[model samples]
Target: MSKIAFIFPGQGAQYVGMGKEIAMEHKSAQDIFEKANESLGFDIKKMCFEGPEEELVKTEYTQPAILTTSIAILSVIQQNGIEADITAGLSLGEYSALVYAGALKFEDAVKLVNKRGKYMQEAVPLGKGNMAAIIGLDRKEVDSIIKEAQDVGTVEGANYNCPGQIVISGEINAVEKACELAKEKGAKKAVLLPVSAPFHCSLLKPAGERLSEKMESLNIGSLQRKVISNVTGDYIANEKDIKDLLIKQVSKSVLWQDSIELMLDGGYDTFIEIGPGKTLTAFTKKTARKLKKKVKCYNVENTKTLNKLLTELG
Candidate 1:
């Protein structure tokens, strides 16, 4: 009676040659990549398989790249007769989860994410917004630090990654001030992240507003599987709320920890991270440990991981 969930990674997980192997080996995976290339009107396949590294890192490029690779891998997994009972993703990955749950078409999701990336990148001026990871601090401690740091600039929690790890984002001065305060208050590490913009913070509210307008022209369908929302960290109760929650998700802290807890409590014991890097896998294990729950983790970026998954699960 082990239920499984398919989770996806968000931005910052892309690397050169993410989906090359699978695309070369599996027609299903290759088709997904082809569809993405056609959908975006650019050679995303080249950027992913043989990246210049510079173009791949741009926020406008990064979001759809990761989504394309993730969906390609998901196609291969499904072709092998593997599936998940539920789905969720972190930040940008939520759109991929919606696609897996039949709430979105891949073509539409790709176009939407492309617009989303551009909007977010343009929301804040470069070098003005910043993000930092505060390790070894509890939620309340991070909250206190953020509130205290606001005197210096606007700072707020970005992602509640796990019990002892949190990411803060906002104006550069405020984020730096929060990092200094976190270290002084016994944080193990407060490291600045190399990201383009201050994502998942109040500073990006304008990006959410832009996304709302873009989504107005898009169509939403019925869900085929249960999917969780990054804004609520709970089952999306109504499809009508998807647009609103996604808009709020851009400016609010991503409730990744809560999403994992909800799945764990619902008896989802196996998690398959269907994406490039193992970021979501690590987060899931950390969250499970904090709640004294046991779970299995797997990721499929290339043929090797995919084979391992088939051997163990198939």
Candidate 2:
């Protein structure tokens, strides 16, 4: 029998009015938003529903908003009897996965992620660090390009998103140089990402350090379900490992492609992306095609989409 895995997307997936439909239509969803506001001590729902786009995009607000929205949607799905056998998320999404797995409480995850976002945003000065996407380049070639640009600064592969799409992050100069080198190495295209910080790179070490200290003060628990780590592409089974990996994940490359493969290898053929955007679903389809695997992927952003997914899965 095929098992279902619920995945969540990270920072770049958020948009204005992402969770408004659910909050407006479902009491459970509305309760979630209200709880998030209470737990966070602010009106996160307003920022998510009526964002100026710029304010919503701020890292601090973005992380909690996405987490709350995903958990709210998950609440709705669970009410309807749709459950996940395993859970995983990418980067910021990992917090959502932990909350779903019961390793972290929703309220604590919200506060922690808010701090995480703030620390990450403050890690590097504006314009000092950057990120870029190199499309149509194999991992080896992308790695080579990043290595070649290391002399300019500390360029490194950050997000292994799909078979031929990788994101690199580092010093702004190094990232720009890497993009040029990627084009020369026959990448289909290399473009700078519109992000504020060089996430998932060595430049984020300070942020990781801060997060580690903050995490030490929190009460983390054992997971109710399996959760794959983005740092190692492995299932984290212990609380110690979870804390360690979460800290390291800030400056470590996100092995998203490997995590997906690991899940596929473990008998999860259906992946349900429970978040605002279909970004992960799109990437999963590409990866599945490249690996010649017959996996079904779905993205449920609202009740209508959730209903469709349940019907299709049935």
Clashes of 1: 0
TM-score of each: 0.99, 0.98
State which candidate has the highest TM-score: 1
- Model 1 lDDT tens row, 56-96: 99888888999999999999899889988799999999999
**Per-residue lDDT of 279 in model 1:** 88
The runs of at least 3 residues in candidate 2 whose Cα sits more than 4 Å from the true structure, single-residue gaps closed, are none
TM-score between candidate 1 and the true structure: 0.99
Tens digit of per-residue lDDT, candidate 2, span 1-314: 66899999899889999889987888998998999999999999999899879999999999999999999988888888888868889999999999999889999999999999999999999989999999999998898888889998999999998899999999989999999988888889999999999999999999999999998878888788999999988889687788889999999999999988888788788999998999999888888888788888889997688779878764
